[model samples]
Target: MVRRVMVDEEGVEMRVRINDMKEMVKEAVGNSGSSQESLEGLVKFILSR
Candidate 1:
């Protein structure tokens, strides 16, 4: 539940979770990352069509 997850009241847990997500996103978009590869593949496919 939302109440259970945010029990700290100061939102420390929420901030930590957000920061973790941000790090993951940065990695996913970094050089040779899966997301970057996937985007390149999609662009190639669209261009070929």
Candidate 2:
């Protein structure tokens, strides 16, 4: 299934992007940045999916 989802390098890149965005949100929350709102929005989005 993993192989099927990641058929090419572009798929790998997209996965990396998602991971990076998740990490950024974690850092923002830890540093008490204004990203809190955005992070919450992201969480809601993921949950809605």
Candidate 3:
């Protein structure tokens, strides 16, 4: 399972890794993207887990 926690960043800022994953998914859904299959595999893994 994914564990998410909030941490004080000295007022700098913070972000979730899922945002990066979504960006990767967007690229995968693009034309002829190499990550297209990878995105599917990741989704399966997450669901199975």
Candidate 4:
């Protein structure tokens, strides 16, 4: 896998994959993201205990 990516000078597929992953990470951490909501829920539950 590493050798294949290194040989591809253009890095087209890798670039696209990296970009998509970045977008997904951004969305997961956004204000109204699922990850944010889960964290908030966990905090509330802990406080209620």
- lDDT for each residue of candidate 2 in 1-49, tens digit (9 for 90 to 100): 6774589777888888999999887877775666776788889999999
RMSD of each: 3.7, 9.7, 10.2, 2.5
Stretches of candidate 3 exceeding 4 Å from the true structure: 1-15, 35-49
Per-residue lDDT value at 34 in model 3: 70
Each model's lDDT:
0.86, 0.81, 0.65, 0.87
Q: How close is candidate 3 to the true structure, as a TM-score?
A: 0.36
Q: How many residue-pair clashes does candidate 2 contain?
A: 0
Q: Which order, best to worst by lDDT?
A: 4, 1, 2, 3
Q: For residues 1-49, write the lDDT of model 3, one tens digit per residue.
A: 1232354553223355666777887887886677777777789999998
For candidate 1, the lDDT comes to: 0.86
Candidates by TM-score, descending order: 4, 1, 2, 3
Clashing residue pairs found in predicted model 4: none
Looking at model 2, residue 26 earns an lDDT score of: 83
